[model samples]
Every structure is written in C-alpha cells, then in structure tokens.
Target: MSTDVLIVGAGPTGLALGIDLARRGVDALVVERAGELFPGSRGKGIQPRTMEVFDDLGVLDAIHAAGGGYPVGMIWQDGQRVGEHRMFDPVEPTEDSPYDAPWMVPQWRTQRILFDRLEELDGKVAFGLEAVGLEQDEDGVTVRLATGGSVRARYVVAADGGRSAVRRSLGIGMTGETVDPNPTLVADARITGLDRDNWHIFPPRGEGDGFLAVCPLAGTEDFQVTAQFPEGSSVDLSLEGVRKVVAARSHLAPEDVTEVRWASDFRPRAALADRFRDGRVFLAGDAAHIHSPAGGQGLNTSVQDAYNLGWKLGAVLRDGVDEALLETYEEERRPIAADMLGLSTSVHRGEVRRGEATRQLGLGYRESSLTAETRQAPATLRAGDRAPDGTLGGVRLFDAFRGPHWTLLAVGAEAPELPGSVRVIRGPAQESYGKGLFLVRPDGYVGWAGDTADGLPRYLARAGL
Candidate 1:
C-alpha cells in the first residue's frame, strides 16, 4: 500500500495529525502496532493551547463534552482531610485567551475523539501494522512492517512512544536525565469510599513509604491511582498489587478497589531527540521528545507537534509550496520541545509552579525563519506570536483563522488586495491586535506583521502563500 504521508502509532499525536491532514485533504494513513487504541488515563491533562488547536481541528466541542475541569486536591493525613491544594493556578478566560485552565480527559478518550474526527474526515487508520524497518530516498519512504508487508509514502512520521521503534531504527540518540530514580505505578480502577469531587493525596507516613495520589478521571467513573516507589524498586501493576498499594497508602480498604481496568509503570525522566527529521522520515511526539508527566507537557506538546507539521505538510503536498518549507518543522518545533522539556523537569523537581507557562498560550516562533516582523515597534501582538482570539468587525478571529488557509487581519489598518485564497478580516476595534496588518499562518501564528500592507504581498509569496 502507499500514500502521501505514513504516520506510525495511533496515539494522540498520530490521531491528531490524521485529523488535521484529513481536513486539509491530505492523503495520509495512520498505522498502529497495537490492535486497538491505548486504554489508560495517562497524559490526561489537556492544556489550553491544545484546546485551541482542537477547536481548529473541529473536535473542540466533542473534547469539551468528553472532559471536565480538574478538581482541587485534598490532602489526607491519618485518613482525615487536612488541607486543599490547587493543582494549577486559577486563571479566568479572557476574550483573547478562551481556555484558562487545563481540561481532564483520559489519554484513551482523547485519542478516541481524535480518531472519530479523523474517520469523519474520511481518514484511514490500519491497525495491527507495525513499522519494523524503513528505507527512504529522495522521492519517498518505503516502510517494512513486521507483518511482512511494505507501505510507501512521500513522508513518514514516527509518533510512537518514548521507546519508539522507528526512532531506534533511525539510530537517533536521546539526551537527558532521570527526573526521579524512583519507579511509579499508574492505574485506572473503580473504587468505593471516595467522593469523586476531589483528588485524594496521601503523603508518606513513615520511612520507606511513598507518596500516593488518586485522582478521579473526568467524564468517567474510574479513578487514576499513582504511587511512587523507592529507587531500584520494581513496580507491580497487577490488580491485587494495586489494591494493596491503595489500602497501604490511603484509608480505603483493599476491597474498595473493586476493579482494575488498566495499569502500567514507569520512572520519571526527560529526553529529546538530537534531530526531528531524518531524510523523508520525521520523528514527532514521544518519538522525538520525552517528558516527565509533572506539568502534563508530554501529550500536549506532542499534539501541538502534529498541529505544527500538519499544515506544513499540507502546504507542500497539496498547496504546491516549496519543499524547503518542510525544513521549518525542525527549526521551529525542536526549540519549543527543548523548552517544554525544561519546564516539565522544573515542575517535576518542584522548582516551578504549574502556572501561565504550563498553559502554553505564550509559546511562539518569533525566531523562526518563517517569521518576518517588518514593523518598527510591534504593539501587543507581533510577528511569530500566536494570534489572539477576539471579535473583529463582528467576525471572530478564531473563526477566520479556522480551516487549512492563511488569514490576513487588517486591524485598524487599511486592507490590501491579495489573492482570493487568503481569507481577509478587517476591523478597527480589535484591541488584541493594534494598528497593523498581520498575516496568520494556517497553524494560527502571525507569520508576518507590518505597520501597513507594504511588505505583505512579498511576505506571502516568500511563505508560499
């Protein structure tokens, strides 16, 4: 079989990419090694920036319906509630930024939502097909599957997890340190004797004990149980083992944990690939970077990776843009990934709080080669910054930015004559954007900004607009 793009792994990253590409009319196939989608509450926090990406992908409504806001944390001592702790700093939604806090959706449920959207867009995913080996040339990539079948494509994306087989096949090296040497056990289970309103936290009572946290999984009856073990200790993921851990840590009895749905174990660590691209194959999500789950940056960063690449791939494959446009994928995302890695590590080590930075709305590509800031001094918004959401001339900025197209925003500035392909929104009251003409990329960043429309056309032609 063959296609324009071959995406490996059906996790949130691959599925989100599939949805974006499908809506853009890009012919792409998502292949997963497992027979079905992942079934865990791992990587459950959906950051605000990702919420915006979901909105553009047409899955925001469903995602909001399938998840709920994270609850406050309730600390327990001697089986009695002591104090309340907020997982994240509270921020109200503003007109410029809609989603203020993280939403809670199990990784499995998020992937399912993305998969359904992909299917709705006529996208395809072939299960039980694992990429074992791959050979790519100047034209395309041919992947050898473990099932003895081969698939070819113009490009391949490895959205596989941290121990990505495709990443290993490419011989790419990961550089980082273990945030914590202690092992951690994470599980989803149905339990009684606990209210679903607060996340229960159990601090170590004595020496050799570990911290335990049981958070109610939003939009579901199951609760995710996480426990830290001593260094050099192996974690137990069995149902009985989970029950024992719960009973030992919290006041609940072993019988309270009635059913264990899914469980796994891991050690907290962070790593990033030396490069994101290798010939025709590219690494994305955990394939390119690994993060400690502290600030919930791994999955959010991964999905955004797909969002960043989807439009570029669409531009080159379907919009006749220069293939050199593809080079920006690494040039732009690698640094962002590296920054997120540091943030996640800081959060893991208690050096940073999960606040504004964790929301990811402030991230941008001002230094990217694709960005052109021609204005003498930009105001609230600038080139390489994320275009804020607000109503301008009765048209919502997000509404205008939606879909696989570039947008020109003439804010308190005279509009220019441009190709009909670029959607234009003109308004004089958009406070988020001062008096300037902004060219918004398909990925929602302002690629070029100027005091007027003087260099706009040239910037467009340079960006293959």
Candidate 2:
C-alpha cells in the first residue's frame, strides 16, 4: 500500500534500481503486468561497462559464475569469417579501470539475479501487477493498480517498456520518428552448425540476405541467434517462423536448428521521450528511449539509466535533498539516450552502406559532465569517458573495485582521502590527473573528477551523497 519508491516493470532497469535502493535500506516495490517472469533472453549479453557496474553492486561474482565470456566477436559473410578483432578477450586492466570482459547472460537471467539480490534486502517483485493510473502531489505519488488496489510512494520510476502506462498518465510525449521500417527476426533458441565460442556476425550472406549474429548465452548450452529481416518480407513469428529464420540463414535446414525454443519479430526503432521526469514521477529504460538492438546497447543503456537514477532517488529519500535534484535525470540521461538512439540508427544505416565507420566508432560517453571535469584533452578515452579496460599497471582496479561506493581513481599515490561523499581509487600514472582528484559514483560512473578537491564537499552536499 505504501513504499519509499515504486517501480513499474520488473525488467533490468527496475530490478536493478529496486535492489540498489533496498540494499541501502529503502522500501521499494516493483510491479509488472505479466504473471510470470520474462520468458526468454530477448536482450542478453551484458556490456563491459555494465559488468563494471555489476561489480560495484557486489554481485559480479554471482553473475560471473552464471554468465559466460567470449574472447572475440567477428563479422561473417555467409558463414565465412571476415572482419575480426578482440572486443572481449585478453581483457587487460588499464589506468583507473575495473572489471574484465563483460559477463554475458540473458535478460531474464539478469532480472532473476537482481531479484535474488532484492529478496535478500526485504524486497520482491510483484508480477501481474500493473500501474493503470498515476497521480502525484507535493508529498507522494498515488498509483492505481489494475488489481483494484493502490499504492503511495515518495517517488515512482517507470521502467515499463516502450508502451508505458506511466508516461501516458502524465502529459509527457515521446518525440522522434521511427528510424526505419526495418524489422529483424530475433530468436532465443539453439543452432547446430555455427561455432558457439565466437560471436558470429553475418552480413548479407546467401539466402539470409541480411545480417545474422550468433552468440553463446552465458552459463547455458543454448546459443542466441539473430537475423535481420529481408527488406520487405516479414516472418509470421510462429514456431514455424523461428525455424524458418534459422533454416534460411544457416547452412542447415529447419531441422538442423531444432529445439525450437522461442522466437519473435522485433521492429527496432529509434525514439526517445521529450522528458524523463514529471514532479514525483520519472521515466527510465524503454520508457525513456527506444532504439535498434544493433549494438546490444539498449539494455545496457537502460540499466545504466537505473544506476544513474537509483542513487539520486535513494540519497534524496535517505537524507533529504531537493526533490528538484531529480530533474537532472533528464538533463544528464536524455542526451545519453538520444545519442544511443542516433548511434544505433547510424549503425543500422551503415549495414546498408557497408561502411567501416559504424563498425569502428563504438559509442563512447567521453563528453559526459562526469568526465568533462577531468578533460584536459580527450585521449582514446578520458576521465568522464566510459573508461576502457586494457592491461595496464600491475593491478585491475575497475573490475576488481566495482561496488556500491564512490571510487576515487587516483593515477598515483597522491590519491587523497576525501571521506564524505567522494570515493577514490588508484590506477597507473600514464597521463594528466595522475595525482589529481576524481570521484566515481556508486554505479561505476564518474560524477565529479578534477585536479583539485575544491568545491567537492559542496558538490556532495548538494547531491546529498
């Protein structure tokens, strides 16, 4: 009937936020319309950055035990491996970095992991519960559930999918056009012919006539297969359709790719909401932005959204900061979401161009305000940047130190002990800010990184950290 925070949708973002808040001793609830957990692994394969976040959450080990990691992902043309490089392997630790190659797991599996963590903190997700109506006042949010019950919360976070009931309840509008009419055939099933170890990305090869990506699911023998739909033709999305996709793409027939587990037709779009928050209500994950799944960044972006907002919400409730601080959710994340939508759109466009640009320029958040404070000049990566991990120094800080605390990444021994809200860690001395001061948020993100600790206590005072 009441909670400190109420979250809609039990997917990755909601689950992660709920667990984070619960761990910090907040009363949180997650509501979902489906009676059962999400059935399949629609958005699996955690990215390197997100794995770092998981490490900070203190659950990386559980995820690692249950997840898998591959060394390389390559581009293929009709089963012939072409463009090749290592994106996941020899995961070396670089300056101020943490974690290794990303731990690959299914979307549902991730939710289960987060839910398990939440349960440990007196939290559980309610499936088949829907927020049909939402009303807000100065004190709290009033949510009308479909089951004829109601809930009151200091704040509500909408992690619902693209068709969000919470967003509609407010007057916020989702602005942007569909990137294209392109629909892709996606499956969470098994295939016989392809090698399971490597990420096999097929480009317009043979009868497939488009791209196909076959990746091994973490901790399971099952392999995830994805193939782009032909320019005009669409699958029926029935069990037979799932078989047909594999049959048409791979060297084998329908019988070759059996088990026929689960399948769907995903119409990937590039769209973002005009706003992410309204009074006591906020939008996150697919509720805030929608984009193509080309680079597997959709879920990562969503989870990061939760990581960014969870601490703010918890901090506000815990120690009493300005509710207005929540407005930064849009100011900070909207651009990131917008950038992802545009980047994914460009990647899909490059699929037709056969251009090398999209394949090379992975999305880098170097321009973020978190990194901007440490910006002298941008290297391949920078302070506010999504810190890239490569073998550097004798230690691995990023992956190893990921946890639910602010990290102060000192390039050298000059790492100062600024206690209140800033976290500090040490990395190799390779560039500027080696002895400088920087702060990493609890979610493995950079917030205030600078050469001096000046105005830092003030920054934390304002964030209520």
Alpha carbon lDDT of each predicted model? 0.94, 0.71
Clashes of each: 0, 21
Candidate 1, 391-439: lDDT as tens digits: 9889988999999999998888888888888999988946788788889
| TM-score of every candidate relative to the true structure | 0.99, 0.82
lDDT of 2 by residue, 33-108 (tens): 9987787878775776677667666667888888876536777655566787554226464443444445568877
* Candidate 2 overall lDDT versus native: 0.71
Total colliding residue pairs, candidate 1: 0
Clashing pairs in 1: none
Segments of candidate 2 deviating more than 4 angstroms: 70-92, 98-103, 198-214, 231-234, 351-432, 449-453
Error (Å) of candidate 2 at residue 56 is 0.9
